[model samples]
Target: MYACIAQWIPPLERPRFIAVVLYAIGLGTAVALPMCGMVIDAAGWPAAFYVTGICSLLWCVLWFSIIYSTPAQHPRISREELQYIENAVRSSGTSHNGPTRVPWKSMATSLPFWAITVTEMCNSYGITIIRAQLPTFMKNIFGLSIKMVIT
Candidate 1:
């Protein structure tokens, strides 16, 4: 999804756009955490999961309905916006020919790939632990209910 958004953004604006997108994601997570905790406290843990799942489904539906791979393919895009995107793509010298074939065997044996894999694995482990345990930790250590912890 982000790759698609990146493709639409002009090269000169891409860095700032990506930064904003990342910040928005962080902001969303920050907001969602307390909201989830409140929901869990009110209705139980499964209700929080249900709310998130429904939101994900709605987002997917909206994305499929509104988003196009290219400006030309979009039904409601303005002519000026389409032209602007086309001009940017032409100026950037980036082709939309799609990705080159991966050298799987070489990547499998590469030290950099292994390093990145290890780093990502560690990051995922840390995030998962925090996500799965934070509420419990707060409940145990602070003697707070889910709503109280969040509030």
Candidate 2:
């Protein structure tokens, strides 16, 4: 998303747009996590999955409606805004002549890719462990009810 923002927004606006996007992600997680917990308590874990899945589909619909290959291709972008973005991108020398082909083999062997993969694997392990065990741990050890654990 940060990468996408760099493509779609002008340089001066990128940081602000990225901050807004990050804030939105945090806010949505704060709200939706508890909502998922409540849904799980009321219906089941599967119900929580259903709710999130539907939300993902709706978000995809919104994304597909608004997104385009470039600022000029976007249906709702103003001429000034489009020109600003294009000029900024061009000035920065990041504008591509055409679709760049992925260097899949080189990427597979890259140190940065391995570093990111390892970091993500570690992060995912920690998050998954907390998600799977925290409620049970609180219920058993701290005597917290599902509602208390959620909130």
Candidate 3:
């Protein structure tokens, strides 16, 4: 997504837009993580997932409605801007060609790919463990109230 935005948004505007995206991601997760714990405490785990699921679906709809595949195809894009983008891509050899098929086995065998995948998986597990266990840990370890745990 950052790459996609960087491709079209002007260089001067790119940082601001990237900052906005990062802020949205950070804010959304920050809000949702605590809210999920609160919902779980008040309602139950099932209700928490139900609410999160609904929010996720709504986000998907908004994403599809707002994002365009290419600048030229964007409803708000001007012709001159589109021409400039095409020319820029052509000049930089960044233009796309028709898709090519790749074998998954080749990718699977790549050492760097596997290393990155393992690191990403570990990082994801760390995040998941922190989010899933923090509230319970606080309550049990520190005798915190549900409100404090959630917050």
lDDT tens per residue, model 2, 10-114: 777777888898789668866777787798899988999999999999999998998887787788888988888999988877677777899999999999999
Which residue pairs clash within candidate 1?
Answer: none
Off by over 4 Å in 1: 109-114
TM-score of decoy 3: 0.70
Give a tens-digit lDDT track for model 1, residues 99-148.
Answer: 78889999999999999999999988997798778878988988988878
TM-score of each candidate?
0.82, 0.76, 0.70
Question: Model 3, stretches more than 4 Å misplaced?
Answer: 2-24, 41-44, 84-91, 103-109
TM-score of 1: 0.82
lDDT, candidates in the order shown: 0.84, 0.82, 0.79
Stretches of model 2 off by over 4 angstroms after superposition: 103-113
Tens digits of per-residue lDDT for model 3, 13-130: 6678888987897688789878987998899889989999999999899989978867876898789998877676556654566566877998899999999999999988997898
TM-score of 2: 0.76
Worst 10 residues of 1 by lDDT: 1-10
Q: Compare candidates 2 and 3 on lDDT and give the better one.
A: 2
